[model samples]
Target: MKKLTKFKRIVTRIIVLTLVLSCAGGVMPSTFTPNAAELYSDKEKYISYNEETEMYEYSFYDAYVYDIDATPGQIMLDIIPSTGSNYYNYYYHKKILITWHSYNGENAAQYDYENQKLAESIQPESRINIKFAAKNKYDDLSYKDGYLGWESHKDFYVSQIISIRNSDEHIYGDINDDGIIDSFDVVTYQKYITDNLQYKLDETQFLNADIDLDTEITNEDCRQVIDFTLGSSKGFNGATNIGSIRIDNTVSQAMSLGVKNDIDFATAEIKFGVDVLKKCYDPEKNNTENILISPLSISSALAMTANGADGDTYEEMEKTLGNGLTLEQINEYMAYFISHLPDKDKEKVYLADSVWFKNDPTLKIYYEFLEKNRKFYNAEIYKSQFDETIIKDVNNWVNKNTKGKIPRLIDSFNIRSNTAMMLLNTLYFESEWQEPYIDTIDGTFTDLNGQKHLIKEMHSEEYQYFDLGNADAFKKPYLNGDYSFVGILPHEDVTFNEYVANLDGKELADGLREYADPETIRLCVMIPKFKYNYQKSLKDILTKIGMEKAFDPDNADFSNINDLSVEGALPLYIDDVLHKTKIEVTEKGTKASAATAVIMGMGAAPPEEKKTIVINLDRPFIYMIVDKNNVPLFIGAATQLSEN
Candidate 1:
C-alpha cells in the first residue's frame, strides 16, 4: 500500500507541473502525458487537448490555449518595452499600456520603468508569463479581450499566445481610418463585403465595417454606412438618439419661454399676413393675375432685420412684426418654431437665412447684431465687396437653399453703391398629399375679369368641410397630418375682391380655429393644378403698414447695424424689401419656394365622414397652406390659372 501511494503522488506532481507550465506560457514537452483524471474524460467533446499542437481547444469559447517560446525580456518587450519599437509607445500615448507578470500565484505589479529593466536582463531561453491591458485615453477606441492577434503583430514570436492588441478607436463608419465618415468609406465597405477590393481589411477596419456590430457584414451594414454619409440623424449603430440640431442648455431653457408665448406670436403673425396680403393685392389692376405670398418667409426676414434697428425704427418693426411682442420674445419664438419644424423623408420644410454687408473700411457692423442673428435665426453673415460677384454668390446661396426653385435672388441693379447690408431669408417646402388625387378632368377657370381659360382640375373626396357664412371652405391634409391645404370659395354674389377686402386677421384666425369632424362633414373637392411665380417690392406695402419711417433715408436709425458715431459715416436705412415666390400644385403634392430680402444700407387635419358636400373651384378663390396649429405658412389668391 505504501509503494502504491508513492506512485500516485508522483503522477499528481507531474500533472500539476504541466498545468503550471501551460498557464505560464511555456512550451509543454511532447513526451509528457496527462493523467486520466486530469484529462477530459470524453474525448469526443468539443473542449479537449490536442496532442499534436500541444494545446487545448475550446470550441464553445472559440479560442485556443497554446504555449509561447520566448524569454521574459522578449515577452516584456512585446507587451511594453523600455526603448525602440515597443508596443507601449506604438500607440503614441493615445492608449495607456498596463502590464504585469505573475508566477507561483503572486499578485500583479505594475510594469513600470524599473520592472521593464529587470525584465530586459532575463535570458532569451527563460520562460516567462506576461499579460497586457490597455486603456484608451480618449475613450474612443474599441477593444476586445481575447487571443486574437492584430495584423501588425503577426510576425512577432509572442503573437501565438499574446492577448494584447493595439488598435486605435475609429469613427464608426470610417473604415479607411481617414478620420472621416464619407462616401469613400461606403465604397470601401462595399468592396470588402463583395471581396472586390483585392485585399482584406485589417483588424480595426474590419471591426469598423461592422457598423451594426452584428458580427457579420451584410448589405444592411453597407446601407447603414450610406445613411450615415447622407446626413442621417441616426448614427452608424442605428441609434436614434442622435439629433441633427445641437440645442445647448441655454437654448433649451429659452425654448420653454417661447412655447408658453406661442399663441400670442401666432395671432400677431396672422394679423401681419392679412395686412400684407391686402396691401399687395390690387383688385382692379391685378384682377387677371394670381397673387401668392409666404407670411413666414417675410416675417423671418423682417425679424432678422429688426435686430439691427434701434430707437423708433426698432419700435415700429417690433410692433408691425410682433404686434407688441418684444424682440427677445420674437427671437426665442422664431428659434423655437424653426427647431420644431418637421423634416422627414416625405415632408420637408427648410428655412435658411443669410446677411451680407459691403466690405468697406468706413462701414463698421456691430458684432452683437451678427451674433444675435446667428444665435436666434442661425443666419450666415458675410462681408462682400458689393460687386457683381456678390450678386452671384447671394443668388447661388438662395438657389441652393430653395432647392434650385428660385435660381436667382439678386441682380447687379439691386445692389446699389449705397447698399450697406442685405438681410435675406429663404423658405422651401415639399410634401405629398395624405390622400392623393385619383383622377383629373378638363375644366374652365374664370378670372375675376371674366376671362375664361381651360385648366386641369384634380379631383378627390375630402372629409373636412367648413361653412364660414360668406364662403365654403375645405381642408385637405398632407402626409403625417402635420399640415393641410385650405381653400375658400366665396358665395357667387360676393365678389372675390369684396370677400378679401372685408377679411380681418382675427376673423380669419378664428375661422381657421374651427375644426370640422370628419364623421359629420364630407366634401367632393376639385382644385386646379397650377404653377406660377410672383415677385413684389414691399417698400410701399411696408410703408403703408406703419413702417414709413424705416424707408426715410434721413430719419431711419440703424445704429445697431453700424457705428454712427464715427465722422463721415453713411447713415444706414432700409433700402428695399424684395419678395419672390414660386409654387406648383400637382396631383401628388405641393412644391413651394419663397425668398424675402430686406436690403439694408447700413443698419439692417382630420378624419371620419358621414355627410358629403360638393365644392368645385372653377372660379377665382383663396388658398392657404397652414400647419396643425392653424398657423399660416403661405396664403394666396388664385384669380388666374395661367402658368407663369
Candidate 2:
C-alpha cells in the first residue's frame, strides 16, 4: 500500500492524455466485412515456376480461406482457390483442414469423414483435416477458410500466414443484420449441432438457433433468441452478455507500473531486499525505492499437462500439493520474487479491457513459475512436444486468463509433419502519469527550423521541458498529465543504422525528467502517421548485440529447470526476433503499438521514433526501444514504402 510516487503520477496522467488524444485521431481500427459478389466474381491469377525439373513443376492461385470449424462434406471453402492445370494439385485445393489441437473441451470439434457427419461426438479419435489455427505468432502460413496454399513453392518452405479478414470483413459468413456474429451467413459453417441431431443449414435464415456456440439450431435456442429480441425473460439467458472484452482501467501510474512477475528466481533471492535498498540512497522515507508486487495468474496450461487428463488434471497436480492445500494457498506461494533490477524504460501498450474468460493468455512461464513455487512433488519440469495440441491448450489457457478480451493473439496452432514448435508471449498494461499537463488554449508546437507543423497539441500549458541546447533531442517533454512523451528522434541527415551505431550514450535517458526545461512554450511539432513492417531472422541481431551467450548450445545453461537430467535439455536458440512499432502524437493525444517478439522458431514486430528538428513525422526513420536507462532493447526503421 505505497503512496503513488511523482513518477507514477506522471505516467498515469500521460496515458489518460494519450487515450483522449487517440480518440481525437479520428481513426478507428478496421474490422471484418465480407462481399458475396466479390467471392463469386474473380479468380486469383496463377504463378508457377519449376526449378528442379527445369520446367514449370507446378502453378496455381496462392489464395486461401479458413473455415476452421467446418466438417467434411460440410460447406467447406465454397470456392476454394482454383488449382492449376496439373490436376495433381487438386489434393491441395479442397477444404484441407490442418491436423492440430487434440481438442477435448466442451465444444471440441469432431470430423467424421467416414460417415460424413460433423455433429456427432468425436469418436475416441477420428480422422480429420489440416489444422487451421495458428499456435504462435511465428507461424507464417497464409491460411484461411478451407484453402491454404503457397504463393510460390519457395514460400512453402515457411509456415503459412493465415489471412483472417479484418473483422466483419471476414472471408465468409456475413448472413445476419444484427451486427452480432451469426453462423447462418457464414461459408465454412455447413452444419448445425442439436441434441443427437445435425442439420444442414447453409443460409442466414437458419442462424436464429445458434445460442450454445456449437454452431447449432434448436427450437429451444430459437425461442430464447426471440425472447431476448422482444425483451422477455422467457427465452433470455444473460450468460452470453457477460462474455465480452474488458480492459484494465488502472494503467500503472507508478514509475514501473508495479508489475511483479515471478520468474526463474530461486528462494535464496526472494528474501526481502528492502533492507538492501535502504543503504544505497538517502531519502525521507526509510527505503528510497517504492516497490509493487502483482500475483501471477493460475497456470492452466501446465495443470492440464501434469497427468494429461481433465478428471486427473487438477486432481493430479493437487496430489502433489498436500491434502490441506487450497487453490488460494497455492497462489500465495507463487508471489515470492519481484523484478529486483529496475524495470527497463518500456513504453508498452496497455490493454485496458478486463479479461473475461480469464484463461486465454496463459504463458508457459506463468505456469512454470507457479509450479516451481508450489512445492508440489508433481511440479517438476517435464518435456513436451510443443505441438499443436499443446499450442491449443496454451491458447485456451491464455483465453481463460485474459477473460476473453485478447482476440487475434492466439489464432490456432497447426500440427503438420514439418511443423516444429512455438513460443507465444502476451503482455497487457494501462496507466497514466501522476501529474496532468495543463490544458492550454490553442497550444501550438514549433519545430527547430521555426516551422509550424500545425500540430494538434494536447492543449497542455503545463509541461516539463529540457534545455539541452543544440543536440535537439530534448527540448520539450510532451506532458499529457503526469506522464512525459519523450522521443529519441534520429538526425535527419543520418541513416537509421548510423544513428543506432553511434547512439551509446548512457546518461541520455534521465535527461527527460532531470535536465529538461520547465517552461510553457508554443511548441509547433509535426509527428507522422504510419504503420511499419520488417522481416529479418534475429540470429544475427542477438549475436551482434553480445547476447549470443544466451543461445550458445555449448555454453547455454538452463539449469533452473527442475526435472532435466542434463542442465540444458532444450537448445536455447532464437529463430527470429522481429520488432514492430507505430507512433502518432497530436493535440488529440498519442497512440502507439510496439513489440519485440522473442520467437524461438517464430515472430514480429515494435519500437517507434520521432525525428524532426523540422519535426514533420514524415518519411523514413529508425527507432530503438529503451528502458528508462535508454539501453537499446530493440531497433527498428520505418520506411513508408519498403524497398528491401
Candidate 3:
C-alpha cells in the first residue's frame, strides 16, 4: 500500500511539473526507455550491455521533479529506486552523479550523491537541463579487460525547459495563488512570517508574502493581509480590489438564507426601502416636498434595537426592516454585507453603528444584547449620563461617522429625560461619476405644484437605460462601478407620487435588474444639480407601517434591553425614530450622508440595435444611490430644486 501511494505521489508530481513547465512556456518530450535486461533480471546488476549498441548501458530508475523556485534558481529533484527497494540496497556500491547545463550546452554545476539533492545558482530567464548518472565500483572484469577500476555508465537524462522570471511581478498579497487575496492567504503569510510554515514558499509566494514590498517579511505584512481580509479602506497596495473571499459562519448563514428564499437578500432590502418611501411620501399633502431617506441607515439602527427586544416589539421591527426574515438572519446578512462592501479612498460607502445607554444605576442594560451588537454589527457601545454632554458626544459621533455631512444628530431637546438609550446608524457615501458631466446648461424644473424654478442641469450621456413602463430611468455608474446613481422620471401622464405609490418592491427590484445593453442603447441624461437636507420623526411613519407595538409604551416588549425586575422601573419603549439626511448632486459626483437614530426610552434587459433613450429630469423624479447588488443605500425624490 505504501509503495502504491508513493507511486501515485510520483505520478502526481510529474503531472504537476509537466503542467508548470507547460504554463511557463514548454516542456521537453520524455525520451526514457526501460532496458529489457535490467527490468527482467536485476538481482545485483550494476550495468546492462546493449546488444544493438555493442556497449555497456547504465540502468536508470524513475526520477520525480518536486518544485522550482526562481529567486534562488533551484529545482528540487528526487531520484528513487524503480523496484521500490531502499536506496541503500539499490545503490549500495554505486555513486550518483548529477550535472546541470545551461541552454547553450555550457556546463553549470555538478554534484556527487550528497543526500541525493542538488542546489545550483541559475540566473533568471535562463534554461537549465539536468542529467543524472550512476557508476558502480567493479569487483569483476568484463570481456575487454581484467581491470577493477570504476567505469562510467550511460547517463540517464530528464530534460526540462525552465524559464524563470522575477517573483516581484506577481500578485502582491495572493500568497496561495488562488487568484484572490483572502483570509487563507493571510494565514499562510502569517505562518511564513513566523517561520512555522510547514512547506516552503516559492519565489513568487515569498514575494507575494511581502505585502508592503519592503524585501523583508515582518508583522506589518501580516497586518496588511489581515486588514485586506477584514476589508480595510486603505487596500494592500492595489491588490485589495479583488474583493473579499472570507466566508465565516455568519456569511454562510446569510447565504443559505438568501438561497432558501430563492432571491437575493438585496431584494428584501429594497422592498423595505420602497416600503419606507411609500409610507413617508404623502402624494396629496407633500407633493412638492423633497424627501430623502437611507433605508440602510434606518434598518441598521432598527436591527440593533431589535437585538434588545423580546416579543411583539422584535417581531414588528423585524418585519419592518428584514421583510419577514428573523433577527438573527437579518443580523448575519447585514453583517456580511457591510464587511464585504467594496470601499475605495475616493469612492467610499462608510456605514457605522453605535449604541449609547444612560449610565444610571437604576437602568441596567443587558450585556448580551450589547455583545451581540458588537459582535455582529461592530457597533461602538457607550454608557453615558444622558445629559447635555452626552448629547454632544452622540452628535459628535454622528458628525464624525457621517464625515461631517451631518454636523449634529441630536440636540438637548431631542434627548429627553425619558430616553434611556439611543441606537444610531450613520452612512456616508462620496463617489465621483464614472463619466463626469463636463457641461452644465440652464434649465427649468417644474415642481409638482406647477411651480417652475430655474436650475442648472448637469448633462451627460449614459449608456445603461431602464424602461420602467410608467417611468423612464437611466443608471449612471460611480467610480469603480461598485455603486451607481439611478434616476427614475415618471411619465408625463403619471404623477411622481403616483408612480412611487404604485411601485412595489418586486417591480422595482426586477426593473432594476433589467436594463438595455450600453453598446446598443445610449441615454442622454440631464439631471438638475440639487442639494437638500431632510429631517423627520418616523414614530408615526413606522406605526403606520405596522410597528405600532414598538411605540406603545404599555404593550412594547423590551425586557431583553433592561432589567425589569428592578422596582419602579418603567418599561422601555421606542419614543421616536429620528431620520436625518443630506445630499449634494453636482457635476463631479454625489456626496450623500444619512443618520437614523432609534431613540430608546424606558421603551424602544438586452436592447436590439442602436437606440438612444433621452431621460430628462426636468420635473420631480426619484433618485437612488444603489450598491453593486442593486440594493438602495439612499433613496429619495427631487420634487423641488433650490440653489442651497
Candidate 4:
C-alpha cells in the first residue's frame, strides 16, 4: 500500500512539471492568469530577416498585457531595426508597424473611430483592408492573425498578420499623413513636439513625425510645419519647395491638352519672348536704364489671367499669349513646363503663382477657374480685405517666395479702390556655371549709345555649344545640364538694336536647334560681368502685342473672372501689369529673381582646337537664360553695363 501511494505522488508531480514546461515554451493555458509586471520587457527587439523563408521575422520576447478591466489606451512604439540592415533601403515599400492597443466592450465605438483615424493617417506605405467581413464592418477592424480584416472580435492576442516593411517615406511636414501638409498637420506636429498629443502613434507615425528627418523630434519641425501651412515659406522639404505645394494643390486629376511637342512649344516660347523683348526695347516705351526681363514669369502670369477672360478680351489675349495653340494646349504646356523646371543642389529654380481677391461678399469666383489654376499652375488662392495692409501682405509673400531678392514689390497704395483682385507670379533662380569664368579682368564695353564703360570681363576657353550662323551664339551651361546661359554677340558691324529687330523667332529657334546639341563644340568665350535690375509696367507692351482689349475697362469682357450676377458686382479689368526683375552674372554663375504682378480693380575646361569659334561681347549684345527644352527663362539686351 505504501509503494502504490508513493508512485501516485510521483505521477502528480510529473504532471505539474509538464504544465510549467509548457508555459515556459510560450504556450499559456486558456485559464492561466497573466501577471501584468511580467507581460512587458524593458529591452525592445528589432525585426530580423530570415534567409530561409525570405521573410522578415519579428519575435515578441514578452507579451504586452492589457487586463480585461483596464481602460482602452494606446502606446507609441519605436521598433527601429538594427543599423546597416537591408530593410532601411526599402523606401518605396508601403509599410506600417502595427501593435494592437486595446478595444473595450463598453467603448467599441470610440475604438472604431480612433482606429479609423489612425488607418486613414497611414499612407504611401500602408493600406486598410477594403474587403468587407461577414457583416458591414471593414475586415481590418477586428483582431485576425496575419490578416487584418475590418471585423470586430474579442480575442486579446493583438492579432494581425502585417506583412508591411517599415515605412521610410515621409514628406517633410506630412505628420498627419493625409497626403497633404496644412494647418491641421501643423497643429498635430506642434502637439507632438510639446508632448500634449492625446493619443500615442505607431512606429511609422513616429518616423514621419520627425519632420526635419534628424531622427529626433524638436521644436523646429513644428515651426517648419507652421511656416509651410501659412505659406510664409516655400516648404520644409529641401528636395523641392514646388513639390510640397503640389501636394496641397491637388485639385482634379483630369489631364489638360499639353504642348503638341517639346520643340513646338519651345519655338512658340521663343517667338513670344522675342515679341516681348521687341516691345520692351522700343525707345519710347522702355524706361529701365539696364534691362532684364523674365519671359517665363510674364508669360505664365498672362496665361493664368487669360483663363479668366472671354469674348474679344479673351480672343485678343489668347492670340497674343498663345502662338496659335488653344487655351487648352497652353494649359497643358504650362503644366508640363513647371513640372520639369529643375530645383536642386547648386542649381535652384523656384516658380510660384498666386491669386488674391478682395473679400467682397458680392463677388463669386468660379470653381472651374480656381481648380484649373490650382492643378495646372499650382497657384495659391486667397481672399483678403483689400485694405492698406494688403500691400504688406503681398510684399511679404513676394519676399518669401523670392528668398528676399525683391523685398518690397509695392507701396501701401498700389491697390486702388477699384481693384477687385490681383494675380502674381514670382520666379527665383540660382545656379553655378559648369565651367566658371577664369577671373574678372578689366575691359572696355561699348554701350548702345556709343558710350564706352570700363567693365570686368569674364573670360574662359572650353567646349561649349557655339554657332555663327544668324549671330555668334555660344551656350554656357550651369552646374547641371538642365539650364544654359546663351549669349549672342552680333557681328561686329551690326548694331545691337538692328540685329534684335531683324531676329525673328524661327531664325533664333533654328540656330538654337542646330548649335545646342549635347555634343561638345570647342569655343573661346569672353563676356562682361554685369548686375542689373529692371522694372516696368507692361500695359503698353501687351496692348502693342494685340491684347489691347484686356486693358480697356469698357471694352474688356472679363465676365468669367467672377460671377457677374452677384449684387454689387462691378466689371473686372486688369488694372496694371507690373514686372520687376533683378539679375547678377559673375564668374561663378547667375542669380536672378523676377516678380510679375497683375492688379485688377473692381478693376567647362577645355578641348580647343578642332573648330574654334570665338565670341567677344565687347559691344552691346543680346543674352538669354534658357532651360534644356530651349524655353527662355530671362531674355534681355545688355545695352549698358553698370559698375558693381
Q: For model 4, what is the alpha-carbon lDDT of residue 64?
A: 15
Clashes of 3: 9
In order, candidate lDDTs are 0.66, 0.28, 0.66, 0.64
- Kindly provide the TM-score of model 4 when superposed on the true structure, using C-alpha atoms: 0.59
Q: Which digits, one per residue and each the tens of the lDDT, describe model 2 over residues 86-195?
A: 01132343333322232222323432232233323222111112222222222223222323444433222111112222111211122242234222222112222212
For model 3, what is the alpha-carbon lDDT of residue 323?
70
Residue-by-residue lDDT tens digits, candidate 3, 287-346? 666889998899889888889887777777887777767788888777776676657755
> For model 1, how does the per-residue alpha-carbon lDDT over 1-644 read when each residue is reduced to its tens digit?
89996776565445444433543453332332232234444332223344643434322111111222234333433332211111123222111122443221222333343345444443321222232222211122212222222444323211122222222234567677545665556556556665566455654466577654334567777677665554454564421221122222222222232343356777777888889988888877857667889988999998888898878888888888887778788888788777777788669999988788777887877777777887778777777777777776777677778876776677788888778788889999888788665335677888877888888788888877888879889899998998899998999989988988997876777777775787676678899888777888999999999887778887887777777656656778888999999887866678888999998764330005467778888898988888877677888888878521
TM-score of 3: 0.58
Q: Clashes per prediction? A: 3, 115, 9, 18
Q: After superposition, how far is residue 583 of candidate 2 from its true place, in Å?
A: 6.5
Per-candidate Cα RMSD to the true structure, in Å, reads: 24.4, 26.8, 23.8, 22.0
Superposed model 2: Cα runs more than 4 Å off: 1-385, 395-425, 429-462, 465-471, 474-482, 491-497, 505-507, 510-515, 520-522, 529-537, 562-614, 621-637, 641-644
Query: Candidate 2: how many backbone clashes?
Result: 115
